[model samples]
Target: MDRPSYGYSAADAPPPQGPTGGPSEQPVCPRHPDRVSYVRCKRCDRPACPDCQRPTDVGVLCVDCERELARQQASTRPRTAMGGRMGRGAPVVTYTLIALNVLVFVGQTLAPQIVEQLGIFAPFRALAMPWTFLTAGFLHGGVLHLALNMYALWIMGQYLERTLGPARYAALFLVSVLGGHTAVYVIADPMGYSWLTGTVGASGGVFGLFAAAFIVGRRMGGQVAQIGVLIALNLLITFTVPNISWQGHLGGLVLGAALTAGMYALRPKASPGADRQALARRSALVHGALVVAAVLLCAVLVAVKTLLVLGG
Candidate 1:
């Protein structure tokens, strides 16, 4: 029953007016001041147009607020379970090692004379050319030799660098190389052809990585049978294959295993409420001292061997 329609329909109603009786001003988006918007961001409660809004878990946020929140989050870098600073998730140290090895190989190929200058010829000569103890690890005999070692280094370096942290992993590698060369020095017959043989390769450091990876895998409950098998096969090859330095491989493996065990045993106990940064620093200092001690042991071995060879 259509009586005289007294109530106004929405379409027929007048626009809302301000106190001055003029049309009310529309709220403009903070990001886009020219655009009028009734929708407000849940975060800052600012009027934001569709273009300036971002969907969040709770509600929509303004673009400015969302960007600021992201910036804050990015500033806080994350740490690994072992207290390694995980920056961008790339293994920087591993890649650096691979590059350095490749570059040195190139140098070796270009200038053949550099090989003698770098390779560990004999303990007696190593005394005069001390740098060979470290540099020899970077020299490879041929393309096949370089490829095999670089492949192994690439595989194991990435994992150890991340887990043990870069500095500790690097220490482990250097010490391993030193141990391998020292073994070669100690085991060689001073009056034999082995003494005159120049040994060059990253086999020492690579074997060390194998031992470390095995220990780490066993600790983390990972499947380590494959690593064990690989090591056994390599050891077999070291004995069977002619020109292979069995002494170096065995020495590096033994020392690497021992050092890794010590480092893990000394690691600070994890606590939910403990300060990770503090714990990581403590672990670093302890691990660093252990590495230094290992180096000293290698030095002592070399010194004693040097005296014996010279005296005889």
Candidate 2:
């Protein structure tokens, strides 16, 4: 680099002279068009001016020899996905699920259940009766009950969706509700079931979301005290409330936590380093296994209950 005698900035002068290039006559930095390069490579010990300096692990490398070494180093290093960083921090799926829940809730409140139906039930069964699990989440037994569960779902779900993304979050909610519904079926006198007081509300799903949030906090959150307080409050209300589905809520909560952990372990995360594709493949297998397991368990329970009744 050349410096004008009369008008010179610090950068206009060349770096110290050395074997590679005299500092007084070094090339300008490519990035900084007029900047002098002071660093000669540690390895080469040649004076490298700015234009020829190459980035390296510990220091700037000689441009002539270091490019090959840098390429090899990069190749050997484990690669990670560059995009979708902080994906866990922000996901559209979380907000969308929340919106859907609120929409369903509002619609259920205004619509007449007399002539119409709240269409949530058994999900993807042989019968494909989604109205069981689906409607159960939307319909509430009373105004207070509806308000409480909806608020809880919105609050905790916001966190779960942010952490787990849409698919896992939805899976967690449904699993939790199904756990609760399963508990109900186990204890209920449903053989004599009627249309009146059978099922309603998001308690099961909300409880599941709560459990997932707590588990997520335990695993990943820096502070878990808030999560603990949340669990405590929800449990207190479940027990104290006159018509709370205690079994449903508890079962759903436990199942949600366990399954969320399982999903996380199997896949680790949604992006970059977590091996998400592998996780998804394994999850699909696991889900199929769970569905089969649930069906068998239900069949056994129904058979045993029926057999006992007949004997009686």
Candidate 3:
């Protein structure tokens, strides 16, 4: 039985109205006075006024409508068993750091002295610049150097960041950088170039991250022994290899270990209490002290260098 539909036409349309009962009434948002509601959410048949509109590339869904949909779908989701562990996927920070290192390495190779003058060329004394301490970790001498360090960084960073939140992870990284630079400033002389020293690559910070991860793993009573073996092997390499920043690596390791201990001391363990928070605060204070002490050490070393230069 074909018949004419009784849909409301434009002539019969009500004036625009907000979600609140207002003078306007054309499916307008309650919050917005001038906006007319024209969109409908597909998931839940809610009329979306301009303020309520949620736009997608293909369609739109209002916030309330999405909640309604999520409520429906949530019932279908099954609970998984316990003992779930984090995946060893690429940690965002680790990947970005590695990419930066690779890019700098390429620049060093292509531009030759350009990288050296900038002090981004790693392991090469004449090519390194004072600024290279920060930039060098982002540069590598060769394929093996780049690959090994980047791989270590990825593996260690993934493990550490998963355990520590992004904020603490960031702090740990910064501390490592400072530690590495301090080591370089203490041990490596600029030779003839006093304004800048030879520095390149992030082995120090990477080593520090590894050390922290190792300590944290042990504290959590997880993969302690495995990490020990890795650390030992790498340490052996520093002694065996030529022209590597052994001092920087060792410095970072020490700092990382200390920070990891600090983090563990701060954790709530099984109990969530004010006591735990207090302990965490105290732990942070200790860490801050260590950083200050390290800075002082760097200052002393710099002073000694000045005296030596004047005497020579």
Candidate 4:
């Protein structure tokens, strides 16, 4: 007996005719077309199998729709207070700096001449290899020296990188290195033994990070008493320990603190009716200007010291 088409259950119903007048197959999942799916995505209304279905507030969404939604949400997400991304990804700049320092240390161990070639020497010699002022920050004197600086960098970098972003943080470290080397050049007596000695270590950059961390921590209302103690102990060691460059440590600390304080002070403040994008642009410009000013200050100091030493 022929049953009415309306009376047939979906599973038992005759397959629809194709354009060529052949029996058409049932609807299948787009991702896995071999499997037939009775369920369809609520959002896109596309056939989605159990594996491709993701539960949402209203109904199941296909994987593609869910991924698209996530992308959209991430695009509109807010940035950090200091204009850095909110994502908690690995600190690439910090790790790279550490790795570079380690590799340089390995080179130093393999070739004893690396220290002489890369380390900062007398002001007159530095004019020939000006890069030494920055490169010296990546060269370590000993295993203990490398370990301590790397540890301090790792501790402070993880926080500062996330707060200030990579470019700003890199500028801070590099400028502080310049500041440290410049201090050493300006303070060293041409006739003294220290003037001819080559200085190597990441202490200058690490000290800069320490100072920045202390300032940022205090500004963000975090407990900074530990940072204070750390700085004080290191300063004490810088003076008491032989071969330690007190000038470099003091120079880096002072520069880092001043730069960070100025950056924070000049940062854009939020207001009820303020334009966020405009505020972000203003913040970036101010921060960039501050970093440039710091670099210029370091250059000026080096120049003045060179003139004084040459004139003497």
* Model 3, C-alpha of 85: deviation from truth (Å): 17
Best by TM-score: 4
**Model 4 over residues 68-99: C-alpha lDDT tens digits?**
77765654567665754553689998999999
What is the C-alpha lDDT profile of model 1 across 1-312, one tens digit per residue?
A: 533322222223234455676666766665565677787666566677899988889899778778867755543456544455563468787788888888888888788785657664466588888888888888888899989999999999998988788887888888888889889988988999878888888899999999999999999899999999999999999999998999989888988988898888887776776666677778778888899899889889888977888798
The TM-scores, one per candidate, come to 0.73, 0.56, 0.59, 0.74
Stretches > 4 Å off in candidate 4: 1-76
Q: List pairs with backbone clashes in candidate 1.
A: none
Model 2 TM-score (2 dp): 0.56
Q: Rate the local accuracy (lDDT) of all candidates.
A: 0.80, 0.59, 0.62, 0.80
Better of 3 and 4 by TM-score: 4
Off by over 4 Å in 1: 1-82, 119-121
Residue 278, model 1, lDDT:
73
Worst 10 residues of 4 by lDDT: 4-13
Per-residue accuracy of model 3 over 1-312 as CA lDDT, tens digit each: 532222312333345655586655456443453666667555444456766777776588776655655655543332111111223455676677778878888787899587756755332332234455456566666888888888888888776666664446656776776567666665655463423545556788888888887776776678678788888988999879887778778877887777667556544332443343344445446555555665566556656755675576
TM-score of 3: 0.59
